[model samples]
Target: MSTKEFIKNQVEKFSSHITPEEFADLTEAENSLIILEVPSKDYTLTEIARIIESNNAHVMSLSVLPVSDGSTLLISIKLDISDLTPVLRSFERFNYNVIYYYMKEGEINDIQRERLQELLFYLNM
Candidate 1:
């Protein structure tokens, strides 16, 4: 199945109350969101959030994925475009292996946005 279909299934399983349309709206509102994927072995979700918070960035959502090698934490944070530099520097200081992506305002595509919305909804609950 496609990623969107997978997410829809997961959402249905986790939060049947949230409709597709509502998820869309939630993602739309979070256009300024940044996603960070960090290996769980390097840092726990709380530690990562604390690190981000120390740099003045707010973690809006966090989730974990377990794999054969190890787990990975997926986090969504709200931050200004300009604050990216310092936050990244902090990550480096902490020696975290992180992969990240973000879109400019009005630039988010449907699938990407929906996935983030599903993640936020899933993690929140």
Candidate 2:
């Protein structure tokens, strides 16, 4: 059992799933992850936290890493709640550059899908 625990993971595999280091607050089902990118000089942690808290969520953990682009930073935040729609909208409204975000897969709305399919079919004709 212990031998299997020390498994070797390829770099590619990490892209598709969260690894141990990023599994801090994500270990709980309720927490969700959001990664935002911004010019290091333009962003303030207080501003980011205020935006999230305004949307009624709390930050569980945060990690900031300087991106290869010397002037940019990647801010990874783990929020206490899983629903990110409201938070995402607030970020958009504030013109924040959100690079990536993830939560559990949401259920697809069949009605919306059907409508889109009909629209595409009509457009093709």
> What is the clash tally of candidate 1?
0
- The segments of candidate 1 whose C-alpha lies over 4 angstroms from its true place after superposition are 1-39, 71-82, 103-125
Quote model 1's TM-score. Answer: 0.45
lDDT of 1 by residue, 22-120 (tens): 544455333234445567666566777777778766655444444345565554454433235556667778876545544343323555689999999
Q: RMSD to native for every prediction?
A: 13.3, 8.1
Q: What TM-score goes with each of the models?
A: 0.45, 0.65
Question: Residue 3 lDDT in model 1?
Answer: 31
Residue 54 of model 2 has an lDDT of 97
